[model samples]
Target: MVSRLGFLGVIARLFMWAFLLGLAVVVLYPLLWMVLNGFKTNAELFGNPFALPTGIDFGNYRDAWNRGVSGYLATSVLVTVTSTVATVFISAWAAYGLTRVDIPFNKVLTAVILGGLMLTPTVALVPLVRMFQSIGLYNSFWALLILYTAFRVPFTTFLIRAYMIDLPREVDEAAQIDGAGRWTAFWRIILPMCKPIITSTVLLHVLFAWNEYLFAMVFTNGSDVQTLPVGLTSLMSKHGTDFPVVFAGMVIAAVPVVFLFLFGQRYIVKGLADGVGK
Candidate 1:
């Protein structure tokens, strides 16, 4: 019986690992296929989608990059970088204030902020476009920047606030006694300690802002200001028959965010698991 139980345990563990591996492949296959096949010609792709390229035909990357991917990539990077930084800063400070301060109507204020999370962004598209246009920021980077920041703020605020609420109050008291004001206490004593979750939040938002397409498509019409995802699609239209070049453009847009997630995956897991239900 002992031998049989041990055998079953080993089998179970193997099965579990195999299952997870299968799931990873299922989820990752398309992205893997996209990147690898990106180097192959249409004829080559049709001949063997799964096989490695016969030779590295880097012209696809060269042509696409020279045409417009570089500009779009730069634009996307600019928008995502600015929006992510601003959002993180604003959300962190707002969360710290919400969780740490004992202001009147605090519950209501928090609820309103959190409520924004539940609201569908699609619902506000029309008014938002008009509003941005009225303010003369539409069809521009500032428009998309503001929209991205606003859309991401609520959830990030909630995430930071949830973690902040669970953080030990003793730290705050000690900071105060040591002559740190509210802002200083948060900056010096608390923010540093929340690095795991904050990093996770930044990564999450970076991915969001990077991949964001609808707003980018809607807000920025010109190739001069379009983001990667939007610009990649536009590249597809212009190079529809050139599957390799289109795929190459897609790969360029996707690689950074993919690597970013993979590298910071541990932080993401720890952030979500940390202080959860505490």
Candidate 2:
């Protein structure tokens, strides 16, 4: 009976491994297929989507790069980096204020900030457009930066505040006894402790600002200010017959996000779990 149970356990383990392997394949196959087809010609892709390319075609990448991807990628990097920095900085302070500082109507303020999460972005689109246009910010980089930072602050602040609330009050008290003011304590003590969640927020912001299409399309008109998502769609529209080039462009745009997730996936999981759970 013991031998039979052991045999059953082995079979279960084998089945689990197979299930996980199949899941991995299902998740990875589309990305792999895109990368592979990026190296093929239109004829090759159309003739056989599943087969390997006849040769490594570098032309698609070069053309894709030339056709606005270079400019779009640059703009995307600028917008993403600037917005991520602003969002983290502002949200961190807001979180600190909410969690650490003693102020009147604090709970009301927290609720107000979190209430932003319930607001539909589309509901504000027309008002935002008018506001930006009136302020001379429409079709500008600042417009994207402001919108991204504003929309992201609520969620980012919530995450950081959650993490901050879990920290021991003794640390702040000890810092105060050691002649550390609020800013000093926060910068030297609290902020460092919140690094994991902060990193996760940065990653999330980067991913959103990089791939976001609606705001990018609506806010920016000229080629110089358009991000990768908007620019890539334009590329697709212009070169509809050339699937390989579009695929190559997609691969380029996706490379950074993929690498980021691969490297900091642990922080992402931990931050969300701990921040939300607490």
Clashes found in each candidate (C-alpha, N, C closer than 3 A): 0, 0
Error of 2 at 178 (Å): 2.6
What C-alpha lDDT do the candidate models reach, one value each?
A: 0.88, 0.93
lDDT of 2 by residue, 123-181 (tens): 99999999999999999999999999999999999999999999999999999999999
The per-residue C-alpha lDDT of model 2 at residue 276 equals 72
**Each prediction's RMSD to truth:** 1.8, 1.6
Which sections of candidate 2 miss by over 4 Å? 238-240
> What are the TM-scores, per candidate, against the unseen true structure?
0.93, 0.95
In model 2, the clashing pairs are none
Instruction: Please state the error at residue 274 of candidate 1 in Å.
Output: 1.5
Q: What does the lDDT read for residue 17 in candidate 2?
A: 100
Evaluate residue 80 in candidate 2 and report its C-alpha lDDT on the 0 to 100 scale: 97
